[model samples]
Each structure stands twice: as C-alpha cells, then as structure tokens.
Target: MDITGERASESLMEDTTTEGSTMVIKMECTDDQPQMRENQEEVEKLKALLAQKEQENDLLREKIQTCQAPYPLTPETINNSSVPNYFRYCTGFTYDEFNKLCRFLRLPDSETVTQTHIPLNCDKLDRHTRHMPLRQEFLLVLIRLRQNFDLEELAFKFQIDIQSVSTLFSLWIDFMYDRLGVSVWPHRDIITKNMPDDYKAEFPTSFAILDCTEIKIEKPSSLLVQCEIYSNYKSTNTLKSLIVCDPRGSIMFASALYTGSTSDQEIFRECKIKDLLKGLLQCGYLKRGDGLMVDKGFLIEKDAKELGLKLNIPPFAKSSLRMPVSDVEITKKIAKHRVHVGRAIAKVKQFKIVSGRIPNSMLVNINEIWFVVCMLSNFQQHIIQT
Candidate 1:
C-alpha cells in the first residue's frame, strides 16, 4: 500500500509539471497577439499604398504618351508634306507665296521665334510646352482664319491641345495685324498708278471705291447690345466697317468697326474718311477733283462737295416710279463699276472666319481680326485686272 501511494504522488508531480509548461506557453501567446495584429495592419496599409502609387505611375505614363508628337515632322516633312497641305487648306498661297508673305510680314520661323514675340497679353504660353514650331504655329493661325475650323478640329489636325490652338490663333492674329495691317494701305499716288484701264477711262479721277461691309456676329445675350449690333439690312447681328478699295479691287483703307445699327452714310462720317481725304488732298497726294465711287447708301455728296471731293453716286429714285432713261443708263454704268467693290468685299470674306458669323468669344479682337483679314486679302492675286 505504501508503494502504490508513492507511485501515485510521482504521477501527480509529472502532471503538474506538464500543466505549468502549457500555462507559460499560453501567457507568451497572449503577450504577442497585439504586436502581431499591429504588424498585420501595417502590412495591409503598405500594400494599399503600393497599389495607389502604382496607379499614379500608370497615369503619368499615359500622360507622357499623349504628350508625345502625334505627327512628327522633320525639315523634309515640313517642306514636302506640311507646307503643301497648309497652302491648300488655309493660306491659299503656294509654298513659295506663303514664304514670301511671311518674309514681307516679318514673321519669324517657329523654331527661332521666341515666346516673347507672340503678341497676346495673356500667360497662355506658360500653360504647356511649345510643341509646335513657329512656322507651324503661323500656318495654324492662317488655316484657322482661312477655314474657320473649330478649336477641337484644329487641335486634332495640329496634334495639340485645344487651348494651345486657341492661344496660337490669338497671338498670330495679333502679330499679323500689327505687322501687316498697316502695310495694306498704299499711298494715294500708288492707287492712282494702279487704277484699272476701265476705271481710268470711265472715271479718271476716281480715287477709291467706297462701301460699308458687314460681318455677322454672335447674338448678344444683353438685349441692349443685341439691339445696338443688329443690322436691318442683314437681318442679323453684325459689326460694320467702311472698306475702301483702289480701282483694281485692292483694299486701301479699312475703318474701325462700328455697330451694325450705324448707317453706311453715318459710318463714312464717323470713320473720318473726309478727314483722311482732306489730309491726302492737302498733302498734294490727291487732286481736288479726285473722287470716291459710291453706292446710293452713301449720302455724303454735300460733305464731299465741302471737302472739295466728288461723290460718284448712282441716281436715286427719291419719290419717282422710274428715272429718266439717261439717269437709268448712268445708274447702270455706276452699278457696273461699283460691282467691283462688292467683289473686293467678297475677296475679304473668302476667309470664312469673316464670312461666317463671328463667335462672341472673338468679339474682343474683331477689329484687329477684320483689319488682318483685309490686309491678307491684298496678299492674294489682284481681284481686278487693268
């Protein structure tokens, strides 16, 4: 009995040792649980951050691809492909003619031209890298005027963003107007020398063809502005200018833009054509008998007489059903000659930007744009022959 009791005590001791060891292991696991959880949480956070960074990297790569040139061009490509395409699509000049005009206008090559040379007052150039060469930029502006392409369309063609296209257009328009607009008007002696034979024979003293041309514009949101710009003749909102051309249909003078509500007679008066004529006459550039060929809308005969100028106007119906046959014949003859003024206006309108209704966004520069378009028209072949 004593032996059995001793064996039972030893087994109990072994059981106690095993239970104590298991308790120690459980305590250790409890102590490590919070640290393990923190480690797991940190791993999850790092994984999430890695995924986010990877996504950002992918976006940056895509942007880089988009910014790459869509149509790469070397000098050969520019001369061979781009020049001809631009000539046909926008400038209406042959490659050689375009180059000549660029030279005459003092336009610098895109590669060499500094950003400071662009005439816009805004900081648009700071927004993006200059992806286009200056030559391409010049062509882009000319094409925009010639075709009146939407900004998006021009962006796609030029492989640039729309904002860049718009900025380039604005800057180039300003440049062209500043550089070339003043050159459009030649001296009165030049006009006399370039007079067509038909004009010289029929009206030897005719100095210029006088007319008011209208360019339709976006309807204004303000009722007052709409009323002021609305034209009864065109039945649309418009801006009007007094365009004077030599007998050969070359524009010699373009007045400041006026509200369409202004009458042709009023535009002539407000534009100070009389003052300009007076100056020319006093300078001995024009003779006292030198005259302006005009349509009936110009009722400045009295003003012309006071200025020592003649108004070659067609006969008016005043209150009669018809005029004398001689007056009718004279009207026909005046109309025949005056038709060239309309043709000259058409040449200016060939630039669809002027021919079509101008967007309100563009109204701020409409005067300059109008002047530039008229000047550019002179770069084309003569609208009339001698």
Candidate 2:
C-alpha cells in the first residue's frame, strides 16, 4: 500500500550470467487498485475492532474494582491519618471523644457480643463469622445513628450483610444505653457548679429546667396503638420523652419515650423525676427551696409541695389575659433562663436518627436510641456558658 491507496505487486527476473559478466534484468509492476482498497478497509475494521475490545477490557476491570471493598474501615486507617477531624468525618466524634468513648464502652465481654439474632430486623441468623473489628463496629453504630444510613448502605460500606448491620446496631445501642444511661442522671454538684449567673440571679435555687420533647414516629397499623401514640399538639403520631436540663443547659435527664397522648404534667408525674428530686434533697443535692423551672402548663405545684420543693411557675390571670407587672417580669425571667433547655434538646436532636420521624420497627429500641443520643450530647461542649 502506498500514498495512492493502491498495492503494487512487482515481478523481477534476471538473465543467467557467468561470473564477471554483465546481467540483463527485467521488472514488472501490477496494481490491483480496487482489491487493495478493499483490503485497506478490512485492515481498518480490524484495528477498530481491536480498539473496541481493549475498551471493553478496561470497563470490565473498572467493574471488578467497584465490586470489591478496598477500604473497609480499620482502626489503623482512622488513626494513622494525615488529616485532622478525620475521626469526626467517619463517626462524628472528635479523636478525644472517640478515645473517651473507647474508655467508657470498653470491649464488651463475649456474652455482650453474642446477641440474639432471631426476629430482629433481619431474616436469618448469620452465625457464620464476619469478624468486623470492634472499633469499626463502634464506628458503624455511630455512623448509622449520626448519618442515619440504612442497613444496606452500612452493610456495603463496612463489607457486611444487612442482617449483621441490624443485629450489630441493636446490640450496640442496647449496650450503650445500659452503660451510659445509668450515670446520665445529673449529680447535684455538677448542676450547681455549672449553673449560669442568670439562673443564679433570677432563680438562684433552680434545681432543673423541665420540658417535654416529642419525637415523631411511624403511624401504627393498630388503631388502638395509633390512638395511644397520636398527639393532638404535634398533629401526628409521636412518642414523648421528658428531657430535663440543669440551668447550665446540659441534659440532666432524658426519660424514656411515652405515648404522645400523655400530657406533659402526666409525664412529669409518672416519670418519677420528682421522686428523684426527693432523693436528691435527701442526699443534699437539692434543698427544699431549690425549685424546678417549668412552664405554667406543668401543673405539679402540689407534687412539688408534697416533696418539699418549690415550683418556679408563671402566674395565670383568671379574669384577663394580663398580669401584674411583677408577675410578668417573673414570667419573663423564667422564660429567658429556660431557653438553654431548648438548646440542650436541639443538641440531642442533631443526631438525625432520633431527631426525625422513626420507622415503626424502631419503636422497640427507640427509648434506648433516645437515651444514647441524650447521653452522648452531654459529652460534647457545653450548650450554655457559665
């Protein structure tokens, strides 16, 4: 093939000659222009086909890489990092906080690790070993709670199955609740020492700020269950939890989830926070005059009196919607100081799992999840300044 896109077939011949004798030579050239053109096209088609096969091979390699888990989390990978806040990126815990949690939730015993696999959120019990590292298991739980990743998403990321993800979360959440929940009830000294100046000046003896925070939950199929949990105030099905904060705005208490239909005052009475207050007073964590800061709707003045504690509640005007100037000022002061409680609740809600409307299946462990988030919130920086 030449520049003219034609092939030239040349025939050469030489006349026989003795040594040192000159020889006569003849040359003939034949060009099959059309056949050469067809051969050129065929060669080009072969080249294109080769390139296409190479590209297909490259794509096959990429798909293979995608199928394998190259970087399932390991402690060495997290700790040997060059970047700051890498731990926080993975599990929303600073390095110090992560280490602190490691200290608190020490590696569970074999009994703690052996969770019942039947009838959880998964189908079959995968007794076959998929040995995820303990820290990675902890990280998986945090990621699910903090980021609210579904079972499939977590299973893929951590190189496990959906059943393992469910079982691990249930096991770890309950373990965390048991370990951390017991000590979350604030000590009298912690609250008093951390109380802010505003509380000191306005309500100096304030024991705690009380409020009912509601978490939206899936509507149950059973109408009776629905009726039990439906909340007129939230205008949806929800579970109510009593979250109390000290004056400094750290969560002092987070009660278990109750029916949304439960009144705030009813929750207040039944949750036995007042009983704890009595114990605190008996233990000298509180004095008789140290009262709970609450909204007017929290009608437990009689209970407070029975426990020998005062109620720093706002006055209600019967005849008119106006109150005396002193009464209004007192109410304003209570409202102003109670803002930290709302901020404390907001901190707990930052964990989107408990903050958002939870699935119906989660109702079983919702209390533990809520308690864990509340307990974890206390480990973060203060919700209010001293």
Per-prediction TM-score to the true structure, in the order listed: 0.75, 0.73
What would you estimate as the lDDT of candidate 1?
0.78
Instruction: Please give the range of 10 consecutive residues that has the lowest summed lDDT in model 2.
Output: 7-16
Lowest-scoring 10 consecutive residues by lDDT in candidate 1? 68-77
lDDT of 1 by residue, 159-229 (tens): 77788777778777777778875534456678768887777788888878888889999898999999999
Task: Please provide, for model 2 over 1-386, each residue's C-alpha lDDT reduced to its tens digit, 9 standing for 90 to 100.
Answer: 67444322221122224321342222111245667898999999999999999999988865554343243665557767888867676666776787677667775423123223222222333533233345567778888888899999988877777887888898778778878866455666677677777677777677688989999988888999999999999999999989888888888788888999999889988887877777877977777777788887788888888988888888887685668899988888988988888899998888889888899888787888999998888777787767
The top-ranked prediction according to TM-score is: 1
- For every model shown, the clashing-pair count is 2, 0
Off by over 4 Å in 2: 1-71, 75-90, 107-130
lDDT of the candidates, in the order given: 0.78, 0.76
